[model samples]
Target: MSAGRHGRHEPVYRALELIANGLVRAQRLDLHVTGLENIPDTGGAVLCVNHTGYVDFLPLALGVQRAGRRTRFLIKSEVMDIGIMRFLVNHTRTVPVDRSRGAEAYRAALGRLREGYIVAVYPEATISRSFELKEFKSGAVRMAAEAGVPIIPAIVWGAHRQWTKGGARNMGRSRLPVHVRYGLPFTPGPDESPERETLRLRETMNSMLLEVQDSYGPHPPGEFWVPSRLGGAAPTPQEAAVIEADEALRKAEARAKRAADRARSRGSRR
Candidate 1:
């Protein structure tokens, strides 16, 4: 869903307003967005969120839309396959990513930000079984560093509980309280190593997550474990298992996808 796909960008502004208003009405959840002033009234910027629950996406976008800005997400290809979602995202300038192709995703993400659209991507790239931040993928760090835009750290709380541990999927009209918090944008230091960039971003995200969580009284157990600093040790063994599984699944999926693509190409050539 490239920004250029849509002709005449006027509808995008009105449409986002409708979507944001609808999301707030339907969810009936309270939202408190801090540092809203930090977001430049206009221009391209990256909003990095902690991915946990399904509702997190809407909350993340709602914050951007609320601040009177258009948001483009570097999302999964599967999401784009949905008819309504694809239409909405395309009009909004989202870049759908097939993680199997890292280089392609990078190019697409960079392209959107360069085009003066606010972009969002999750550093962890997947939800945590336990509500603790996992070791982040370097994508957010790389994208933010290369794009050279203010990366705003956002945190979402309460969406994780909407999922039942058994299915851990689908919340059909489920009533879940949600909170969104945005942190002041920060510039990654000059000559920063990928490691440093990743860690710095992680720490900012961690703080924002904590602030959002704390705002929702009665902490969701284990939210306290993520330190105020980035690249900190992961949670305990029980929690680490989920993070490990997420990593392994992502790697396996990426490999399988590439293999399939190569096989298809070879067959086509034959």
Candidate 2:
């Protein structure tokens, strides 16, 4: 679908936006948004964002809203399983991807795109504990290709300072500055491989992220929010990979223990 063809925004989404804006104001966040014009006024587009922190989506969505477009984010099914989150996601029309059944979510996102809704996806798939760009997944490029929509590269910087993994949370009125930038949209060629397109998209967003960081000012030495290369104490990407791997192993073990306990309980009952 072309630009300027989408339907009106849902009432719940509008209401949530108001609450979110109020929260932003309450926290006195110093938000800097640029290149919003790159977001199509009204059209189906895949917004590929680099994830740095838990609240990265908020600032990025605010920037897109400034462009007069509401974004439907592709969220994980685990988050959707939460009672409150489930209600919010359902009411706001967000698409949920079950990792075990990813195709279902892909179809849902594609349908939304074809219906002319801007779909935001984090190609990194998770928050970067290292505060650096993680490797990109080809799903965003593949979705854009199938949906015939442009891929909009976006970057969010400085959000990790507020709240991040293994870091102290400061959701209070700290007056933190978060920067959001939107790069020009581009569509992959029909013959281009998804892997190649995904790599190019990552490179583009990485460059944009560096630019945002540069303009965002100097990083405090040994701070947890900045990447090690930039002089802060955040772990290097390689170290972060190990940490994430350990985390995954722990989660798997916990799940197995739970399953075994459930089985034993059932046997005792029998």
Candidate 3:
């Protein structure tokens, strides 16, 4: 196990880690991990992972644990509000972020990094409905730069097969394969702008993801969660854009109808 410079060792956190990691192992999911050596044995670093599904975070956490470190994730504030999830995340020392207030989240993450803890951020901000890397926001790069820690790009593919934002009715499959790969950490120059660094980070992550997919061979058929390149039913970015637009239009129409109905009721009363 790689030694962490200042990993958390609270009894409760350790207990939960054991249980959650045990659950992951019990799933008997096929997990292939690479670039384990790229993780520094001891230091505070920003771990930037591409989110694909509900269970994507676990695989990355397991890999980080295997490297002898603990990761505190910048998680959605909604999850922090759930009863059991709140308890678990609090014990895990995770940072909860109101998605709209990114600055607050960055400050919290910066505090963790200054304390020599690894902070994980999903730069894409959400699960990519298209099942491919999307444009990254600048938060991760900014956090790394401000904290003076290197950004470690970790890519996970195949977890979407088990569960994804679109659908997961096929999760009962006997065997699911998940690939997790970490990359060499790099620091942004002090003089470099966060925008440029973000672009570089995105490119690095995309290239690494492509390599992961190619090496994993073809994704099986009838799997809607798999990316299009792997011959699955996942949507492309353009397709996803149209789907989102249509959904938004439907929602707008619903809201307008409700408003009209309320207005008609008021007029009838008068």
Listed per candidate, the RMSD to the true structure in angstroms reads 5.7, 2.0, 4.5
Please identify which of the two predictions, 2 or 3, would achieve the higher lDDT against the true structure: 2
Model 2: per-residue Cα lDDT over 140-219, one tens digit each: 99999999999999998977778889889989997899999999999988998999999999899989988999999879
- Which regions of candidate 1 deviate over 4 angstroms? 1-13, 82-85, 164-176, 220-270
How do the residues 40-84 of candidate 3 rate in per-residue lDDT, one tens digit apiece?
A: 877689999998888898889878878877888887788876899
Q: What TM-score should be assigned to candidate 2?
A: 0.95
Scored against the true structure, residue 165 in model 3 reaches a CA lDDT of 68
lDDT of 1 by residue, 1-270 (tens): 233222235586566667666766675655555666766676567788887665577766767756666677787888887899888777666788886687997898888777767788888877664556777888776777787877888887766555523234534455556777778887666598878888988987777776666566653333332322323232554765666688799989998999999999999999
- lDDT at 228 for candidate 2? 89
Off by over 4 Å in 3: 1-8, 169-173, 245-270
lDDT (CA) per prediction: 0.69, 0.88, 0.83
Model 2 residue 75 CA deviation (Å) reads: 1.3
Ranking by TM-score: 2, 3, 1
TM-score, one value per model: 0.75, 0.95, 0.85
Best by TM-score: 2
